[model samples]
Target chain A: MKQQSKARAHTNIALIKYWGKRDNKLFLPMNSSLSLTLDAFYSETSVELSDSFEADSFILNDQPQNSQETAKISHFLDLFRQTAGIKTAAKVVSQNFVPTAAGLASSASAFAALGAAMNHATGLNLDLAELSTYVRRGSGSATRSVYGGFVEWQMGTTSADSLAVEIDDASWDIGMITVAVNTNKKTLSSRDGMKLTVETSAFYPAWLESAAKDLVSIKEAIHKQDFQQLGEITESNGMKMHGTMLGATPPFSYWEALTVEVLTKIREIRRQGWQCYFTMDAGPNVKILCRYSDAEAIQKLLTTAFPDNPVIISKVGSGVKLI
Target chain B: MKQQSKARAHTNIALIKYWGKRDNKLFLPMNSSLSLTLDAFYSETSVELSDSFEADSFILNDQPQNSQETAKISHFLDLFRQTAGIKTAAKVVSQNFVPTAAGLASSASAFAALGAAMNHATGLNLDLAELSTYVRRGSGSATRSVYGGFVEWQMGTTSADSLAVEIDDASWDIGMITVAVNTNKKTLSSRDGMKLTVETSAFYPAWLESAAKDLVSIKEAIHKQDFQQLGEITESNGMKMHGTMLGATPPFSYWEALTVEVLTKIREIRRQGWQCYFTMDAGPNVKILCRYSDAEAIQKLLTTAFPDNPVIISKVGSGVKLI
Candidate 1:
């Protein structure tokens, strides 16, 4: 049995947010989405299959995980074992530089790295396509982290089809400025939020129907390398997701005053003819998509305006790698 | 002309929110909405037409208003003169206990009172139906203030048909708890916001399609005096309006952090077997609908939790009246 195998992967921000689950068991999305793999946040993980190990043991960020987290990792390892045709127990350890469960897509990198490491440890050597599906079954968004730069998550009906595919290396002068609007833990988990939104939002059906059309336009924009078209659609798509959340039962909002403040400034910059726009995930943070040349300027303005908030500039990062 | 006339009217909270304009000039809504007139906030105005007046001079709260405010009132008065066949300028004095243009429906009471006072001053003797049309020409929601307690604004196709009709006097045990989340002036006018949403939101057409169905269900709920049904629909309707805003071209939200805090608290209370629900207007504040019996307890909780916020308990209020 392999002693150990390791891999690293970066998190990706959805330019077009994937809000709800169509099929929870397979982590199938209600609609297709697009994302950009980021350079800043990442996770590194190692997995070993050996008779010395009594059972599947997991550690994250230097701390032994609780039963729930351990069980989840164990279940994922079982899937890997089934594919590899091995009964050996595994010891898995992961380190995350990114904030976990704070809407920063930490799980994407974590699971993507896990998928790659397991493949390597078992000597299965699955390609990105198989690895993407494996990562998706663990976390829906982790599928996108399997590839670098710009990727598209297709809302396929079956387990085999619903996986992310690379659109571009994002070699164009495109970058993002991320503002840490709120790094605090969210009150509602994304899984629970998706469930609530799907069950209660009156506009969920409309959102589901419109996402395919948005995906089509966004893909064309990517192919054409049209920055304006991409930025406009990206911003609209994010807003549509939040709008659906607002229609949830009892209603809720992830936005803070600072989020709006950052958005207002982004618009001010855009009004000056800069190709700058913003997209927010389930958290209060705002990610501004702009030309690489303009990213520093936008970040500087935001830092000057809100010195308390950390501002980060990220480029197109590399794909998951076995190390 | 009659020497002088005076009237008072209360502000109304839309359980079913009014958003977007079908015809900006006529102040027509694209979808029907429902509202409850509240006793906590109102406007009192007195108008006098005399030969000594050279033009329409207006004083609000013992202070002269700017030309913009003057122009809006003057313009509304012109419509009244055209109907009465009189060309006399008028001196108008107004007092607003409600916050003006801050999403508290000050315009509803202002225009409803103006409509009644003007009709009386000119001896036109327009009834509630005719007066609703007149008030709507000034402010779309003012038509609802023409009637008392609970009101429904039908999204009629033309100027004459798009008028408010009384649903009931709200004699049942019902009330709302007001949370002053952001009493500051809004950055965008509701009129401008409505125009932008109507023009840009992809989900807007869906909203328009579903509004009539919501109206029917809410009306049935009202007739049955089913608090749960009415509360659920009201909460859903408000969320849908905000969701539409999120789909706007640049996208915007009327929520602040405290707004979410209040909503979270409301949901917590609801889970404890209470029939409390919330709705927000064009600003950050939230109005919670609850049984009159539960209003005080809810208000106390909010007041204790958010010491800086003003929490008020309100009951169903009367319609426009000559004073």
Candidate 2:
């Protein structure tokens, strides 16, 4: 086995969101989802296996992780050790490149990088498609982080079938700008939110149906290189995901006052002849999808409009790979 | 025909909301809804039928109305004239007691008072239930304003069967507070908004089903005098109504930054052991549902949190009556 192995993976933003899980244990989605991999945010992880280590240890962003956090990483690493027939303990170090207080999605990149580094250290030499299944066990969206540009997480019936596939190279005029609207910790995690929505919300079934249609249409738009269609579908799909949360038994919203303000500003900018659209995840921040040439201008406008908040611009990014 | 008649009607806030409409011309809602009438906001109108007048004229809020506004009143008065078999023109004078730029639903009170005054002036003398059908034609929600306390607009198959029915007198410890967050005119009117939601939103069918179930549950809560259950149903229903709009094609939201801020404050107050909940309409304003005794205290807290916004408290109001 390799002594040490390092890998890096970039984050991806869902256009047709993967909201609910059909199989929680395997992290299988209820519907297929499409996303764009971006250059700004990423996670680089190094894994070292040795006979001298007492137990598995995890260091994240230069800080030692608690037992609970370390256990999660160790449990994930066990899958590799079981396949390779080894009982060696490993020490993992991960550094996240996401902005401070941005509240962005880093778990996708983090788990993807860890999956790549562990695979290399174990000498498994698995293909990217096979590696996605392992990455999904860490986080559902992490499956897509194994590929570059536009990737799709197919909602397969079995664990072996559910895998990420690259759709488009995203080499054209595609760009993203993120507005960090709030720094507070989220009251509800995405996993808990999606579980409540699936169990309680009456609209969850409809959301799944709409998402399936959106995935088909978005893929067509990507093939045609139609930015307008892609933007509209992405914005509408993101809003629909949040909409289901509002119908839960005890309703909740991830949106804050500044989130809505930034959305309104985006619409106003669009009315002024700019081809920009907005999408939000399970948090208060807003992401603008626009033409690559228009990203800098849009970032400047958002920085001026929200002087206290951080504005970030990112273009198309590559897939997970060894250092 | 009588020379003159005057009537007053109080506004009602929906606990279980009416969103999409089934019949656009007759203003029939897709689902039945429940609401409570409040004393703080109302409309009073006087109607005088005369042979000397050649045309119908309308004076609203002590000012002469323009042609477009006068035409709407004339069109409503034509229904009374047609029913009474009279050709005499009527002079309509209306006064609104709502706060300046509060964005409260005044159309319900306005049309209910107009219906009552016209019923008396034209000697139609229709009972309140029969008058509710006429009031619904002017505005869908106005049907519920014909009665005081808790009222339900039952969705009927035809124009004659569809009418407002009083469910409970609401004489318990029921109270409300209005938070006027924004004074700007809404970009999308409720009529257009519902139309788009019904036509474009994939979740519209689910909303209709959920609303029907909510109407049944809320009525049970009202009957049992279960304040907590009633408040929960009301808040959930209102949020679900707004949620449907977010799923529509070319999605939109009636919420503003201040609107969300006020909601956060209300949630914080609830966490501090206050039995207060919130509901919203097709605009940026928010209304609180709480125990009659807690109204004053909640109002004070909201005032301190949002000093620039107007917060008004109100108790249960009576039904439409002659002056």
Candidate 3:
């Protein structure tokens, strides 16, 4: 039989969150955050041991990766090699199945998929927590993507303790509508942004303090399967994350004119008696969390409201699995 | 007594700093910040009770004031009327002697002088602390400008307790250099930016927790008259404040190309054994804190480095006083 290659993986979105780093090199966070792994948007990442190249090679979205772009991949490969006791080079090719132009947690799904695929390829028999640690080393949010359904990336003080855990299977009533304003890469990377917040913003401490409470409330809401509570917390957290940007000494604004317009429209829709709420992650795009039945109507409304923009409706997804 | 119509006040820079609000309407802070009053930059205002006009008028930098531009003054007047039981209208004209393009704390000076002048006009025997509280109700930072030399704006839980206090009457060796970059106003207002930070930035809490330490250390340095320590702390705090902005969800960058160039040059100069440090407020302009004797040389060096930019040099200034 032809050598079975590692399976592809997808990314996930955090309903709770994982922010800040205890260790820059290790990507260790000060606390854990919870998330829900959605089915519709994901990245298919396959890793295989290759003897041809001296270094790891990454092909992202069917394009050849540059040195800067593959840095994270190489870092992950190095860790994988150290763990698996293999000196051979590896090849990582990822095809993102996430909706075109949809602003979703592609990184979370991508890294989580990669983590699981690489783990399976190496036959490490690592537990979910170990897999999450490896995923977090690649991207902070990816740690939570290791499991499907409702998940949490616990902000443990140490890398050993900080790992993603499944909170609930989320097989029931949860749906999302991702409004894609632009699919172009963000101007600022989350890693660089987090570093900047640690170094500069005066209100950073207050954000950290409040986030813990938000995380706690979100967890409780998730346990109760309270979509309304979950949506509210997620939206509030998203807004809070945006707020820090405004207070940085010299100050910066993440808002495009369209961002405000979309937000206002979302609020208007919410006022119109739809059980819908919105959350944004590191981009101008907004994802509306609502009942699975409401997804179609919300998408239609958003499409009409934002005729120039594209919207993608998705259902609750499964965790990382071999394709 | 020439009607004692003209009054002048100087602005102050917060070395320790105060950020966040307990109450939006009252401008109460979560903690107090310490600052230094600079002799170099100040605003002079002449207020005269007028019977000609039905409303208070303001003239800024020799330009005629419009109603919309005088909103802050109007807000202050309304507050003053409620506090001091004053029913009369006044005409106010103010000139800022400080470099218009420089990012010095002009509002602090403007409001400080305004507070003093309004007090004089109203014959309200409000003490410095009470005056600070009153001014702070208008602008949070203005409270620190009430006192000269080393001043602190205590971030008390309530507006009544959150007042600016005099630390040391900074008679010692301290100098400042203002580097004018872009004269155009920033896109993000400090008020909105700070509010966003408090609401969003994940690193905000860490910043708040550590700020007290920074405040304590910098105060000790100021008490010991250690320019080196003072400069280091000020620069670090300024950088930290700017960092939070970058971490905001969509992320924002307040840096201009010139900011990078100037910062590089400043670092290069420091490597050449100069005891100079830089701090920036909400604008692209930079202010360097150095010893009195080194001010001229540093200014000359900076001017040479950026031939197109204007540099203003000034000494440690006095607080707001009757002219």
Candidate closest to the true structure, highest DockQ: 2
Show the lowest summed lDDT stretch of 10 residues, model 3 chain A: A1-10
Q: Per-chain TM-score of chain B, candidate 2?
A: 0.98
For candidate 3, give the docking quality class from DockQ: incorrect
Tens-digit per-residue lDDT, A194-304, candidate 1: 899898776788788777788888989999999999998899888888898877775777777677777878888888778888998887888989988888888888889
User: Candidate 3 lDDT, tens digit per residue, A52-137?
Assistant: 66887889888999988788787786776788887766788888887666766567777887877778777675898888888888
Candidate 1: deviation at residue B67, Å?
6.0
TM-score of chain B of 3: 0.93
Per-prediction TM-score: 0.90, 0.98, 0.60
**Candidate number achieving the greatest lDDT relative to the actual structure:** 2
Q: How do these models rank on DockQ, best leading? A: 2, 1, 3
Best by TM-score: 2
User: Number of clashes in model 3?
Assistant: 50
**Model 1 Cα lDDT, one tens digit per residue, B24-82:** 88888888889999988889999999877888988988999888999999999998899
Hey, what RMSD does candidate 3 come out at?
Answer: 8.3
The parts of candidate 2 lying over 4 Å away from their true place are: none
Q: Candidate 1: where is the Cα deviation over 4 Å?
A: A1-4, A51-54, A64-68, A99-103, A181-184, A256-276, A291-310, B1-3, B49-57, B63-71, B85-89, B99-105, B265-276, B291-297
Query: Over the stretch B1-323, how does candidate 2's per-residue lDDT look in tens digits?
Result: 43899999999999999898898888888988889999999999999999989888999999999999999888888887899899899899999997666668689999999999999999999999889999899888889999999999998889887999999999999999999988677788889999999999988999999999999999999999999999999889999988898899978899998889998999999999999999999999999999999999999999999998889999998789999
